[model samples]
Target: MGRELLRIEHLHKEFEGKTVLDDLSLTLREGEVAVIVGPSGCGKSTLLRCVNALEPVQGGSIFLDGEEIHADPRKLPQLRQKVGMVFQSYELFPHKSILDNITLAPRMVQKRGREDAEAEALALLERVGLADRAKDYPRQLSGGQKQRVAIVRSLIMHPALMLFDEVTAALDPEMVREVLDVLLDLAKQGRTMLIVTHEMQFARAVADRILFLDDGGIVEEGRPLDFFDHPKTERAQRFLNTFTFETVKE
Candidate 1:
């Protein structure tokens, strides 16, 4: 029920000759956490990418904080600063030390002083329980550790909205929780986020809204309790039934 921070209106996208997003419209409010769930090739990831102008929209428009994103591609740099994304791949710089990888964007793009950026990165590292590994290179850390660092790197920028694209899909079972814990903490802090993930338990525990997409359109969307316990659409019911888990966290 917070102020609207993002609005996707009649959005459309295509790859080659295929339509990936079909006149999709959704709104995200400040301090809201929206979890996107859909079957493979459903365009969940494409929606997030287009929100930040990472992908071009073939039709319709997206507005972030009331500003039209596709209005001018020239303003993308400024528009992108308010959004941050972490992908399934760790995407950490191989040669750079962990701290350097975290600080690189702030130092180059934001033109932040190295001292200030490092200090902030260190503080964020501590928050994620990885302060001790600040100077270590990406290859030296475990998969979970690298993902945690990636989240911290994004958090350091204090983005208005965070986009996560199947971040835990590449990790082993044990490593998944470590990364999810960081995200849970962020949710508790009331950060506005739009996440595309298959982690059903996390979706139930943290999301204020759950959006179920199918065939490039939203099949259903509502509060967690409503959508999870009583999905209106058959497609959503089928999707949930396939991902059965033990004792969903309250």
Candidate 2:
């Protein structure tokens, strides 16, 4: 663990007056991977959106590397540069090439030179094993490939923290492993990541700590082995029982 890279305090969120998250608080260290897991509608995705400042919080604060995150239009562009997010849907532009999709933000938002941005983009693509797909369009790629590209797009920005929100949820069973493998590789490289996932086996393999959310707050948290083998809370136990837990080979 390194310095605290992300901190959420007394976080609260609501949708149409219904509370989604209530008084949720957590901190993520610079090189730690914390996996959030729970049953559906547990506010797992909402929490990630709050941390990224994509959703408005009714109360509480989120600090990224000591700077508070707000939806202030003037500051959000820069703030987002430090926090890269990958969604369940691969939000790549259908018309642009993979390299273009990856390099677009760096070129336009960060104002880097084309050569510099493309060079870095190519390097990141190679890292994700998509070097050949640089010229390919999103529509040409499989769900898994597009998702990997999405991951590469985020990585090229060199974010201090990475957020994954059910990134494999939209993929077929056969496609899920390829995307998960890329994430496992990233975890091995010591990336600070907050992941919302239902893949129990993958969560167990990659998480340094597991946060079990329920009823709009963290119900239980522990190391992977401890959380999986011996859940302290009945909520967590019931949640685990819903999944046929299996060992995921690293």
- Model 2 weakest lDDT span, ten residues long: 70-79
N/CA/C clash count, model 2: 0
Candidate models: Cα lDDT each: 0.92, 0.93
Error of 1 at 33 (Å): 0.2
Residue 198's C-alpha lDDT in candidate 2?
Answer: 92
Regions of candidate 1 where Cα sits further than 4 Å from its true position: 245-250
Error of 2 at 154 (Å): 0.5
Number of clashing residue pairs in every model?
0, 0
Task: Give per-residue CA lDDT, model 1, range 1-250, as digits (tens).
Answer: 6899999999999999899999999999999999999998999999988987889889998898999999998888888888989989979999999999999989988999999999999999999999999889999998999999999888888899999999999999999999999999999999998988999889999899999999999989999999999999999999989988778797
Given candidate 1, what's the lDDT at residue 151? 91
lDDT of 1: 0.92
Positional deviation of residue 60's Cα in model 2 after best superposition, in angstroms: 0.6
Structure candidate 1, residue pairs in collision: none
Listed in order, each prediction's TM-score against the native is: 0.95, 0.96
